[model samples]
Structure formats: C-alpha cells, structure tokens
Target chain A: MNWYRKLSIKQKQVVWAWTFLALPVLFYVVIRFYPTFGSVLLSFQDWNLLGSKTWIGLENYEKLVADPVFWKVFNNTFIYLLLGTPVSLLISFIIAYHLDKVSFLHATIRAMYFIPFMTSAVAMAWLWRWFYQPVPVGLFNNFLASIGISQLPFLKSTFSALPSVLAPAIWAGLGFQIIIFMAGLRAIPQSYYEAAQIDGVGPWTVLREITIPLLKPTLVFLVVFSSIGFLRIFDQVFNMTTNDPGGPLNSTKPLVLMIYDTAFNAFDMGYAAAQTVVLFTILLLVSLLQLYVMRERT
Target chain B: MKSWKKTIIGATAGAVMALSAGFAQAVEIEYWQYFYEARVTAIDTLIEKFEAENPDITVKHTTFPYADYRTKVAAAIPSGQGPDVVQLFYGWLNDYVEAKLITPLPTDAFPPAMIEKEFFPMVQAMKKDGAYMALPTAVRSLALFYNTRLFEEAGIDGPPKTLDELVEIAKKLTKKDAAGNITQVGITTGMNAQDHHWWREVLTRQFGGDPYKDDYKTVNYNDEAGAAALKWYSELETLHEVTQAGFMDEGQAAFKAGRAGMHIDGSFRIGALKSTRGLKWGVAELPAGPDGMKSNYSSYWVNGITSKATGEKKAAALKFLAFVTSDEAMQIWLDTVGELPAKPSAALTDANKADPVFGPFINGLGYAKTTIFANESGQRQVIMDAMQRILLEDQSPADAVAVAAEAEQKILNEYYK
Candidate 1:
C-alpha cells in the first residue's frame, strides 16, 4: 500500500491512460467476443429454445458436411462474393474517380451516388422485386419489350436469380466504397500528379502507377468488408424472392440464410450453430489470408 | 440539476397517480393482431362497439403484418412484453402450446353447445391435451381460381371437376412460343402453403392412404397412394408440361395479367385480385382425385387469451376474444376481409350466402380438413421444404418422398420420446 502511494506521478498517468484504453477493449470482449464464443460452444450441443441442451459433440458438424443443401448454399455464397465484390469495386472506383475530376459539382454527384446506401435494405429489395417482375407491367420486362426482346426471367430463373439479387447489393454498396476511394484519391497530394504531368504521364498511366498504389489500403479494406458482406447475404434473398430463401431451385441461397432456415424454420439449432461456426471460420481465414497478401505487397 | 431532479420527481408522481386511477377505475387490455387497411378499419369499428358495451374497459389494439407476426409474438411473449391477447395462425398453435407460452381457455368460458353449433369440427382439432388452445376467428380454404377471359379464349367451358380434366384443360390453356419456351402457364402448382397441403391431402385421400395415422406417431407420405399422388403432380410439370418449372411468381403474374388459366390459392387472394380492374375471375372447387375423393384443406386464424393474464386484464381480454368471434363481429370481419367466418351462426347468415366471392369457400367447408397427421410445426416445415426441393429442383419424387418421411418420423420420435 505504501509502495503504491509512493509511485511517481508519471506512473499514475500511465495507469490512468491504460484504464481509459481498456474500457472499449473490455466492451468489445463482453459484447462481441462473448456471444461469438457462446455460439461456437452451442454448435456442439442439441438445443431447442426451451429444452435442455444435450451434448452432441461433433455430430452437428458431421451432419452439416453431409447436408446437400448446406453445400448448395455455400456455393451460392461464394458465387455472390466472387461476382459481386470485383464488379462493385470497379464500378464504384470509376464513379469516384470521375466525380473527383469534376471539382465544381463533386458534392452533388457524391450525394446522388450515396443515396442508395442511405435507403433501407428491405425497401430497396421490394423496389427491385417490382422492377424485376416477369410480367409486362414489370419495369425491366417493359424495357425489354420496348426494345423488341421477349421477356426475360430476371428473378424467376435459376441462372438469373443470383445475379438479379446481386444487382441491388452492388447498387446499395457503391456509395460507401465511392466515398472511401474519393478520400484515398484526395490523400494523394497534387505534387505527384504535377510531377507526373511534367513527365508527360497519360491519364491511364497515372491511374495504374501512382493512384492505384496509393489507394491500396482502401482497396484492400473495401474488398475484405464487401466479401464478408456478400458471404453473409440474407435480406435481399429473403425479401426479393418472396420470403422464399434460395428460390428458383436454391440458386440464391446464401450461408446466413441457410443458417436462419436451419435454426428458425427447421428448428435445428445445433445444426444451425454448426453452420455458423463453419462460416465464421471461413471468413476469418479468408480475411487473414487477405491481410497477409496485402502485407506482403507492402 | 436540482430543478431537473424536481421535475423528474413531479413527473413520476403524476405517472403513478395516473396508473392508480387507470387500474382502480377500468381495465386496460393490450390486444395484438395482424391486419392492414380494410381489416384494420373493420377491427377499429368493432373495438369502438366493444368499448361502448364495456364502458369500464379500454382495449388498445396493435397491428403487425402477417409475415412478421410469429417472430414478433415469440420474442415478445418470452420477454413478458407480449399483449394479453394475440391473433395466432392455427399452424403456430402447436409450438406455442408445447412451449406453454399460451394459456388454456376455461372450459366454461366458451359455451360448449355454441362451439359445437358454430365452429367447424376441423377447427376443434387444434386443441391439445383436452384444452382448446385457441378460438378461431376466421377460416380459409383452398380453391381453384380461374381467369375467366383465359378460359374463354382456350374454349374451356368451366373449371374442371376431376384431376384428368384439370390437366387436359391446363394443357389447352398453356401458350408457348415458336421455340417452345413457355410464355404463359396454365397453373401455378405450389403458390401457397395451403396449395401444397391440398395436393398432399387429395393425393393421400385418393390413394386411400392416411397421410398421418390416427396416433400422429407415423407419417405415411412414402406409402403407395402418397407416391402415386406425388408422381401425378410431377407429371403436371415434367410430362404434360402444363406448368412451367421455376415460374411460380411468373405464373401468378401471368394469371393476374389474364394469360394463365388457373391459380390454386386460399380465399384471402380474392381481395387482392378484386382490386385489379377489368379482370374476370371465378373460384371453383379443387378437382377431385382420380379415385373420386375430394380433399379440401382449410387454414384459419385463432385468437387466444393468455393464461398469464389475470384479474380485470384477463376478463377484458376474454371479452375482446368473444367479441371478435361473435356473429356480429365476425360479420364485420367477413364483409371486409373476404374470409369465411369460423362461427356457424355467422357463416349461415344472409351476408355469407349472398356473397359470390366467398361461396366456394363456404361450400368447400363440407369437405374441409386440416393436416391432422403432421401437426408439429417442425415436421410441417420439413415436409414443405422437401416438397419445394422436389418440385423446384427437379428432384426425383421417390427420393423427395423418402427424405420427407424420414424427417417427419424423426421429428415425431423426438417429440414423443
């Protein structure tokens, strides 16, 4: 007790700093880490909401591996992540780059691009559902008919359903990614561009060499977040497909939707928990790999 | 800070005084339901009448959309924030009953003679352990909805009365382009939950096989009759090609646009269809199976007063439940919502007899039956999921039937054990 009281004022200051820093860390552990650990533990037990949980060990994991529907949903999720991420990034980057070029109306153009992000996912999904309707009264079908094309199966066909759902996700996501890219573009001092100009660097050359390299961190962050978002896709599949998750022959089924179906619809909490663990592990590993690749490049 | 504290104290005293006055004077009951627009308007009108009759009690009504009602109730009830009374779907009764989340109505609360006289026997089958789990307010049954214009264009005289005739007429009504891509379908095979149940029931009944045995311990969906029924359903899409694969919503849109011939759905769809202009539509009984068996599946909404509620709250809730199920209140519900009344006295009224839109539903009550065998919600979902896989994914009927039977049996064993 005497030693504690005799400590230096600098020591007390360090202790106070540590306490302030620990508050948020403690909160993260309690709220996020605790529930995640509980979910993983739940994966090993057979639990209905009201009943006593029985220990089943790896049985749920085994069942998940054998379940055909699980594999179907996993494939669908990867397809979405694979197709959705790069396309969204490219489109958003281009829009951000163009908006950056227009200094006068940049703020207005940015707000216009960001409005979709501000809209609720359910509202957007409903609007898109009406847009992709198969009848002539449907917006997309009417457009097709106007161009002398027969009505296409936008949301009704197995082949088109995944892409149709992806369209809205891309549309809603572009605003945030565009803002990030714009910030990254701003961070690159004009001196580099002026230097490149003196050296006779073309627009494409400047983009390839200086702009993209400088924006690597933002690109990496966007890719990781967007991939995670696409992997856990649920709302669009649920709302746009008439509450039929994985509609059109399980073509739009994603990992999170499958988890919900298993736990809530099928009441197989243990199996659903197992699926969640698997999804969490996959995302963790993929993100780690991405981080390593980015580090290596740097 | 001192002034703020004083204000808080003053507000707290005022709230306590208001609460004491409310409790001492009249019962305020919280009632939850899923209704919008016309149904909401009808319910609001009924509430005004109810409040007039029971001047001492005030009912606060909350509304949710039909889709989110189950989840909202489940979360609310567990947290003890649920309303004193809730409108429940018959399918949801088993889960809530098993969880003991609902209170059983006192036997004397509802007149037994009135129940026997007014309600269909099918609605009574929802009771568990000799206790009526819910009081059904409205009943709906599956019927064949035909596009009158399309039927006329196809030269079909009227709706089919037999399975073979339905297929034949459906085939004639289907329109295809030169490349053989189906532009318009004849029927949307699996549009709603009742449609799936209707198919299963008609097939099981026709095959002379019980889908679920009397004990409810076994599911016989893989039996010969069940298999035969499923095979025939598959033939509609695969062999005869009257129905298109992966085009259920498309088919519904087509039917709505006067391109398709028939839609198998519940009576609830009539309201939405009626809202459309210049569309001639008619409802008829589902075609009988080849074995001449007519199996009509019915679904309904039930209102149950909570077992947890007590004193004035309980009394008020029961009063509201009785009011909603009463002939007068049911008349308002039926007239506005297009749903058939669960009460016999209400169903037999002139309003019901004269309404052409609801005649098929009322008449179909004669052959009405619920899926008594697979009453468990889990088993029902499993069967439907399997059915979706088979119908949508082009899975082998035998394989789908086996998977469904196995899943159903597993659920039964789990629960019974």
Candidate 2:
C-alpha cells in the first residue's frame, strides 16, 4: 500500500484505467483472437473433425486454387457484394430522401420499411421463394400470367437465380440502410440547405454540392458495413435453395456456403479452414480497399 | 398450524431427495435422431418399455430437425458429448466410420451370420471389415405413387405396367392452358428429389448400365446405355412435354396438389400421404423397362453406438439398440412410420405383402439395390447439375452424363483414395 502511494498521480490513473480495461481485453483474446489464430493454423493441416490432424502444408490451398467450384463461388461472392451494396444504397437513399418530406403517417411508413429488417431472414427468404415459384402457385408468375405476359423462370435458370436471390437480400437490407440514411440526413443542418436556396441553386445542384458532400462519412461507413454483409451472405441463399443449395450449376453459391458444405457436410475441417482463411483475407482486403478509396483527402 | 405446514413441506423435500438419490446410481444414456412426428412417438413408446424392463437404467431421448441432425452429431461426438446411441442415414455410415465417430457392434452380441440370415441382404452395406457398424429399425424402397382421381379423370383404367405405357398415360393425363403453359402435368420430374435415386438405381440398371463399378468406388455411368437413360429421363420434359421440371416447386408437392398423374417416391412417404386430405393415391410397382427389367432403390436410417459410449454407457446403449431393432420395435415402426421392417421375418408376413398400399413397396424390396455412397450429397448434386444442364443449357445427354460421371468420379476418388 505504501508503494502504491509512492507512485506518481499519472501512474495511479494509468493503473486504474487498465483495471477497467482488463476484462474486455482478456475476453477479446480468448473468445475472438484465439480461435482466429487456431483456424489459420488448421488451414495447413489435414483433419476430418474426429481424426488426428496431420500437417499437409499448403496442400489444401493448392487444391482450393485448382478447384473450379471455388473460383465460381468466389465470383458469386463478388457479384453479391458489387450488386447488392450499390443498389441497396441507392434505393434506400431515394426512399429516405422522399420520406423525409412526408409528414402524414410518416412514422408508420418508416416502421413498415423497418419491419422486414426485424423479421427472420429464413422466413423472408421462404416468402420470396414462394413469390418466385412457377405459375398456378407463385405470386409473381400468376400476376404475369394474368397480364398476358410470358412467365419468367425466376429461380430455375442459372442466368436469373443469382439475381432472384439478390433481390430479396437487397430488399431485406433496405430497412436498415434507410434508417441509417435518414439518420444521416437528419444530422445535416438545415442552415446549409437554406443557404443553397438563398443562392437560387437548383435542387440537383444543392443535392450534389451540399447533401451528398455532407453525407460522405455516412456513405463510406455504410459502404464498408454492407460490403462485408454481402460478402458473408449465407442464410437467404441457403434457405431459398434448400432443395438444391447453390444450385442451377452453382450460380448462386457463395464462398461461405462452400465453406459450410465442406466443413459440416463433407467433414473436411482442414479444407474448410483453408476456405475460411481465404474468406477472411478477402473480407479484410475489400474493407481496407473501400476505406482507403473513401479516405478523406485535403 | 405454522409448524404443521412446515413439517409437510419438509417431508415432501425429504421424499424428493430420496428419489433423486435412487436416480443417481442408475446409468443414464442418451439417444438422438432427427425429428419426425411418428418416429419420435415410436421411440418414446420404446423408451417407456425399455425403462419398465430395466428400472435400474435411465434413458434420455433427443431429437433435432433433419437439416441440423448430422451437423449436431458430427460436432458433439468429437467433444465426448451427445448421444450414446445416435441415428444416422445409412449413406453417412462410411463417413462416420472413417471419422471414427461410431464403434463397430460387438460380434458376440450381434453375430454377422445372424444379421445376414435375418435382415435383408441390402443391410450388408453397413458391414466393414467383417463387422456391422450399425443396424436399422426400418427400411425403405421406392414405388410409383399414382393419383387415382387424376387417372380416372383421364379415362385410364389402372397404372401403367411398362415405361412406354407410362409415357402414353402421362401424355393423356396432361392438360394445357390456351397460352401453352402446363396446367396439369402427366408426371413430376425433379432431379433434386428422388429422381436422382430413380435414375441411378432403377433407370440406369433398366437401361443396361451399371451406375458404379467396384462397390461404388468408380463412376461407370459414362457409357451409351447411361446416355440413353439420361436422354429418356430428360426427354420427359423436352420431347414428350408430358412433365416439367420444378413444377409447383417439388415433385411430391405437385403430386399432392393433384396436378401430377404419377410420382416416384420412397415408402417413407406413405405416412405423410395418408394424412393429406382429399388425396386419393395408390401405390404400384415402378414401371418396367422395354426389356422387362425391374429395379428399385433401398435406403434406411440406422442406429449406431457412438465412440463416446464406454463401460456402463456402452452396455446401456447396446441394450437400447438391441431393443430398438427387435421384432416388436419393427412392428411399431411399421405401424407408426409406414416404413417396412428391416428383417425378412417381420417384413415378409402375408398381411404386409398383401396390403394394398404396402404391397407394391414390399414387392420392390426383392429387386432393390443400395448404392454404397462415397459422398451422397455430392453425387446427388452431380446428377442434378446434369439434369439442369439438359433442361436449361441445351447440353446433349451424352455430354451431360460424361460431365456428371467425371465429377462423381472425382468425389469418389477423394474419398476412397
């Protein structure tokens, strides 16, 4: 106790601060960081869950590189990210922009948009699956038939399956993105828009010069966040294609689904770990790239 | 009055403590299976009987949804947890053995000769290195399920006996709208469903081709006969236009909706079909090929003692397993689950063979073949992809068969080698 008293005030404050930080730091190490490093190590070994792991350095990686299905899945993951992020961003922005002006039943309409985000992904995917089914059973197909238009094979064709799957995914995410955009829009001071109006600038010019420029930080954050979400997509695809997961010639199969199939279905833990490592690297690179590109420049 | 009330509470607590002390000495083991209502009820009844016979032993039953059951077993076993006796699909037995998740049944308790003499020959697929790794309580075989109302509406007397007649009947039963869209299909075809098994075990054989060579380690369905089978199956959609793929989402769903004339499904479907209101369906033997060849696919869900079971738990698990596979349990499963009994003694009775709904499925067992799967889902995916290529991409039947064969061979080599 005397020794603690002898310490300087700064040192005492440092000791108190670390005492509070100790628990969460320890938690992050044990719960998060430890398994991450373990998975990285397992990527170089050959294990089938129950069997003893044998070191087969880089072999799983080699096989992954050569596997055509892995490449196709990698392409699909990027497609989800590229297509889902921008379309969701634009649609949500448009809705939030228009919705900000509407006062009648405003809260109720906003709540309606947010409901899908709260609903279960599995339920939403199944609902969308029902909508996409062929005529006499499906909603979309029946409507088309009623209108005298040829029925579209929404999920049956390789060309249409990925987009059909992406549609619901983008829609499910709109609620959350709209909420964020509205929050961002609300944060922008009305004085700037009033100034633009005083200058007699058009609405488009005001949006381009004031609103969008001010909304840059929010856009960057959402871009990174939603990119990661799309990259790691699993539930919607898994549930929609439950009968033939990643089917129609693997058109809708993403990297995460491949990892799941390899790990649980095939019981090839080593290969799955290798795939996980690749996914982790891809996620890290994509996030970093987006951040770097969107970094503030003076 | 307060003291009297306290005394009553104290006495109740004491009695509970004593009962728990008795339970503490009993060996407890868990059994897990995928949740199906009838199977769950059947197992609960068996558990009640097993406990009554052995009051010193206690058993706990667990079930998960079919989608997550295998994953739960795989994760739990290596951690020395979950299910002393676990139920697994017979196709997954090889994976379990290779992963060391299950232990071989003791030959002393389950002699190989007795198993061969009593159980159907198809059960031999469970044998590895002269030891039985698992035993099933019930077995399943494929049969043609025809909607009686649809047949009557089409002016057909009965189900077709040959493949050519099947096509004729299907074409007759089909209905179309003014826009050339199919309103009612002659039959349902989806490779994602039982059609993969039908093509591999029945059609391929009937077309004079073996699906696999060398105990299913090599893909041999790349030949002319295999291509012919593929062509015929796909032509049901392309040329005949009697059936369509993905109609009403699934083949069974279409059949159940009374829009399909015929559906090929396993005996396990009988229980569900029976409960579907207004569905007038009858079972028949699968249509024969042009050469009069008949074939069927047999499969089962088997119970095995996990490696986690040892000593007292192992003994209890074995006792429970033996009871579940006994003749009495088989009868209960057949009654509740509508699956055929695993053993000839229980399944070959006159009543089972003569019953209208069960007779066709029972007759199929005599000519059934079980494929020793290296990777069942992967192999199924190969066939499904082939079907999709033909239906969607205009790929030739020969090319699709060759691609599927090569893809399946790679999976087989990955496992066996």
lDDT tens digits by residue: candidate 2, B67-177: 888888878988989999999999887777887889999999999999999999999989989999999999999999999998998899999999999999999988887
Off by over 4 Å in 2: A1-9, B1-17
At residue B307, give the lDDT of candidate 2: 93
TM per model? 0.85, 0.96
The deviation in Å at residue B146 for candidate 2 is 0.8
Best by DockQ: 2
lDDT of candidates 1 onward, in order: 0.79, 0.92
> Per-residue lDDT tens digits of candidate 1, residues A49-68?
53457899999998888877
Model 2: pairs clashing at backbone N, Cα or C within 3 Å:
none
DockQ metric for all predictions: 0.20, 0.63
Q: Pick the candidate with the highest TM-score.
A: 2
RMSD of each: 4.8, 2.0
